[model samples]
Target: MRNQFVGKLVLVAAGIAVLLVLTPFAIVPAGHRGVLTTFGKPSPEVFDEGLHFRWPIAQSMHLVGVAIEKGEGEGDAASKDLQTVKTKVVINYHVRPDAVVAVYRDLGNQPGERIIVPAVHEAVKAVTARYTAEELISKRAIVRNDIVDALRERMARHGLVIDEFSIVSFNFSKTFDEAIEAKTTAEQLKMKAERDLQRIEVEAQQKIARAKAEAESLSLQRQQVTPELLRLRETENQAKAIEKWDGKLPATMAGGAVPFISLPAKQ
Candidate 1:
């Protein structure tokens, strides 16, 4: 009975030793960092992915992910023309692994909710106010870039890196949309009218050119009609009449007058 009791005591001591040996070691998962805190105070040393050792019951591990994350924000703002604008913003960001401890110490773990959201609103508002509503609609890329630049600098101070940022959407009043549509329609109509006018002008020019050519041809024909040509035409007509006539005089004459003075005195 004494030997059996000693063996049980030895087994109890071995179990306690095993527990002590394994308690200090922790396995930080993939894409995470282990932040160490001793006695409720944060330590400057940060642990990367994989196994790490810490004091039992004295040092605690807090895991934070350093992978890429997405954040969205929206807000109401006024344009440079005092038009009401509603904007939705989207951003991709990630925390710096080495600087995460700084993030936890300075800004705490809710950095995204607390920091990025407000920054997006402010940056969007500030950028939106600089451009007119029409300009905002036309130059959306410029607006997105401005917001990105502003947020990048702001978030970098808190250990958040901006990967990509964009202005997802911008909404304005119904009246503005109608006005744009009407303006586009009017411009198209004006262009059509101008094209019609140009076509008519070209047709008119072609007709004038044809008329001038006809007039030039008529003038050239008139210049060729000389007095000698008229006499030659009359002679040719007399010859054709003589050729077709029989070799005899006319039996009668017109009662009004004779074409020529007869040789009466000689008769």
Candidate 2:
């Protein structure tokens, strides 16, 4: 009976060992990759999501989520125009599947916080330093592109791929904000003044054109009213008066049924 009990205990221990050994072969979840390392040396082979095998004694696996992950960082940077600006930037990134081993070796476990966030902050500062505060605020897309490009290039060394990057917010100093506002207001006023001047000039041109037309009409009338034209008008008036007169002759001795008035002799 004692021998049977000892044999049964040995079998139970063997079964436990086997179970422990098989635990490392479990399936990795979706969106995750298993990075296997042997004797602290990372293997070139990476296991994708699903059941994977690793050496029970000599190898250990690190599960890295290959899905896109988000990170945010903020810092103060100088603009191209020497204005200091504070900016908050957000980045979404992921480890390159083929570079998983390299990433593990270089960045170790916490790639998002250690590698990506710092790289983004550096890129943001570097790119921001090349643009003015006003440009940073208005042309944020350009700044974001620059940052993404710079970060992608920088993080590529660590086997990280930048999925997307954006500037969350940008803030300028109080003095700078006031200055920009004042400048904008001044520009608007200047444009308004220019438009007003143009309007006045157009109105003046119209008035001058109308006065010239009136002057031209008067000159034409003066040119048409000649001495011959005045004589013709007087003849027309006399003809109309004679045509309207009644034909009855006066009884008083006038000049043979026609009244004739002799003008006084001129002195």
Could you report the Cα RMSD, in angstroms, for every candidate shown?
Answer: 9.2, 8.6
Model 2, span 1-267: residue lDDT tens: 999999999999999998886665756788888888888888788888888777787777878878998888789888889888888877888888888777777777689877887777788889989887888877888888888888877788877888877788998889998999999999999999999999999999999999999999999999999999999999999999889889865656745553567699999
Query: Evaluated with TM-score, which candidate comes out highest?
Result: 2
**Across residues 201-267, which tens digit of lDDT does each residue of candidate 1 receive?**
9999999999999999999999999999999999999999999999976655788565666776754
Overall local distance difference test of candidate 2 = 0.84
Task: Evaluate all candidate structures by whole-model CA lDDT and list the values in order.
Answer: 0.88, 0.84
User: Which residue pairs clash within candidate 2?
Assistant: 80-131
Range of the 10 consecutive residues with the lowest summed lDDT in candidate 2: 251-260
lDDT of 1 at 182: 96
Compare the candidates by lDDT and give the number of the best one.
Answer: 1
Kindly report the root-mean-square deviation of model 1 from the true structure over all alpha carbons.
9.2
